[model samples]
Target: MGRNTRKRRMPLATKVTAGAAALALGGGGLVWANFYASAHEDGGHNRTKSRGAQVATINCPDVGQKLTKVPRKARRGVAKELALLDRQITDAYTRLAETRQAQAGDANYVDNAILGPLKSKRTATLDRIGININRAGGTAPRDLGRFARCQGVPVDQPGDGDGGGQNQGGGQDDGSGQDNGGGQDNGGQAQNGPVADDFINIEDVQPNSRNLPNGLAANGDGGSTGSFTTECGTNENALRNSDNVIVAPGVSNGAQHQHDYVGNQANTAFASDEDLANGETTCRNQGDRSTYFWPVLRIQDGTQDIDQGRPGGGQDGNVGKIVAPTAAELRFVGNRTSDVVAMPRALRIITGDAKAFTNGLNNANTAWSCTGFEDRQVTDKYPICPEGSSVVRTSAFQSCWDGQNIDSANHRTHVDFVEADGTCSNGFQAIPQLQVRLVYDNIPAPRIENGQVVNPFAVDSFPEQLHKPITDHNDFINFFDEDLMNQMVECINSGQDCQ
Candidate 1:
């Protein structure tokens, strides 16, 4: 049969079920006759061709239901394996869909060549599941009808690049009395066509000069300076040009939605769990292979209409091309007296709850301020930049580690934030803290809808009901190498500013 017309057959399960039924109904003579016939007509030698035969209908027991009967001791392992297989199947389908979409003319060829191995692997996985179920004294499901079929569906489709803005060179004055240098105009908003003057000018946004509270600064007595610090990719320079700080290393524009990335260079949209575990990093110190990322903050120009249907932007009307901060504040904070150990590999951490943007700010660690106007600090709401000031976004992650688990059931229980005074709590060990600060230079003036001024910027996933601007939230993964982690420990314990 041709590739396009090929259909997967349920040969193995059907043959096995038939043989078992025959064995029960007749004697050894009938069993032998049936086996011989199957061997000649549809056996291992013709497996590939037979797969294109008609699918068989069988009632397989639900694997999930049978899993509950497994002994508690073996349940965890079985569940883990099942989950892994599930992910693999999903990934396979995603790959197949993308291949079909990209190679419509030759999709059948691609499917036969690429999907063939995937089907075999899936069959093997089903067999393994059966073994585990039988070993646990549970009734194994005979029907794998769901697993046998290929449901070609793309895992993620690229959203409309409608509001995407280009990086323009810095320091040009677009006649708005604001410095257009080192800033981006969403969809050519800076061009003096029919664009309105209500949009905020980058030159008008000044830096906050106030000496804000430095909660994340190291407080050690200068004597202990063994710990060193280094930066990864260029943050300030990239921000100046509106360039992407994070690139999806292996895939073409894999990030789908633009985001700022730190640490691992291999972090892309196609990065698998294992890839992240073993991926190389962009950090100056090769030992720090962890990754930090969050969506890019866009600058809104009131002239263009906002598409609430976009992926990253919530259902709110806030629109315009997002931009990165002018300056990124990087720091490590932890116990002032004790040395911090290297973070465990694959230690995922998140800070500044995104959902908290709508609710009141309960995260005491969340901080916000305006550039060139540091005296004005606000939490939960976007800092209203004065005529000569810009907005600064800041977030700090938990610094205390359980000293064992890299991750936990909740993705948070394994790690906890330092005490208000920067001390470890609940017997958790102190780890070098990670603090991120982002500064936004260009913020459009608040919009006037129905004669009322409303904020135009909102965080990536805020609720549609809440249209307020969100300034901060962060994510991190610790994949530090062993030697580098030891070096960090020595430096922090030795009390050296190893920057």
Candidate 2:
């Protein structure tokens, strides 16, 4: 079947990251509402113990997402600065998490000790980014420093926010992504995330709650209707790393999170285009050497992966036993309204935002569901599947190509989701959509009782993202040989399923 559409992007300042709502602990009557509150955008909101809450995280504008048009010559430098921006956020969050008591004791502590310094660092970074662009003969983004100031978000336990945090009997994310994506008053061990409120029982989610992503429709009106499947082993060799060749090509630990890999064996922070073209493949079809990967999902049961002490693992707030997906299905299907075109070799597509927890749902494409409840999926809350059912993560990549560049400054402008009516917009061409489905059978369902959670499963994420399901994402780079690319286009155009 043709793949369903998923995800998009937006401006950074207006977004509110996920966090538990402020709830007064009964009798004690004090809890911290840590997500960025709507009313506190101008300056950080400080709630005293008597006010029933305190701030929990620092929210900042995502500078990288705003640079959609950097010159190609300056992309590498801009990307590095963007990665540094991310690093600055991580450091500030580390401080925020470490100084909770200090935050409570002094109203100015967060703004002075954390957010203020963060703004200074960001200003310098943004200036460097602008310099990089200008030196490359491209106009630098204006007012880049305006995004520097960060806000301290507060969290509520259960019984906070709208709908009082999805019914505890089971939870519902609504998939609209309009509310605070499940709050986290108390972060998990290492103080990074996946608290009790992040999980919702699959049974409680209303069936078919997930709408068609961006209103993408199956082939209709001359659209290519066939499918192509690639047999890429599920990273059995444990090819995992914390670098993103597409986004942060030369920086080690660029992603600040570990990702499981399949398809291209030569993927790394330093892998050049030529290196990838000559790389070995894990796919059954040697003609297809595309790299496909996603964040490693880990079960927080006190065990740790090998990277537990490394940069992208325990050190970055991601802990737990790494759960390899039992099956990783990589499939490509035709567009919804036009005959598909062969994707240019080296085409890179990032379907979701790993920073969506703080960057907002505009680019959150991660879908969580159980095997039996395929019709019900969520963008924010993780699903607590019942026994006999396995967990599933699905990413449907962008299907429209700009027809000119293989990549863009921000890495997103080159491709886009189909319009609401199922057609590519702004002269973008329709290309085969890559859909990846990962299934895990060993993840034990988490138990939440009285607002406390037992073992929970979460995808590895940047330290500040809080490990929310919305931050889940996938990446792909096309390296198919010319003949194979042609065959794929032919197969889809001819309405024939091919392997």
Per-residue lDDT, model 2, residue 492, is 88
**Local error of candidate 2 at residue 261 (angstroms):** 0.4
Write candidate 1's Cα lDDT for 113-217 as tens digits: 445555666667667766766786666556643453332211111112321111111223446664333112233221111112122333333443221233345
lDDT per model vs. reference? 0.42, 0.73
Give the TM-score (vs. native) of candidate 1.
0.50
Q: Write the per-residue lDDT of candidate 2 for residues 241-345, one digit (tens) a residue.
A: 899898887889999989999999999999989999999999999999999989999887777778778898877888778878999998888876779888998
Candidate 1: lDDT over CA atoms? 0.42
Candidate 2 error regions (>4 Å)? 1-53, 156-190, 212-217, 220-222
In model 2, state the lDDT of residue 79: 83
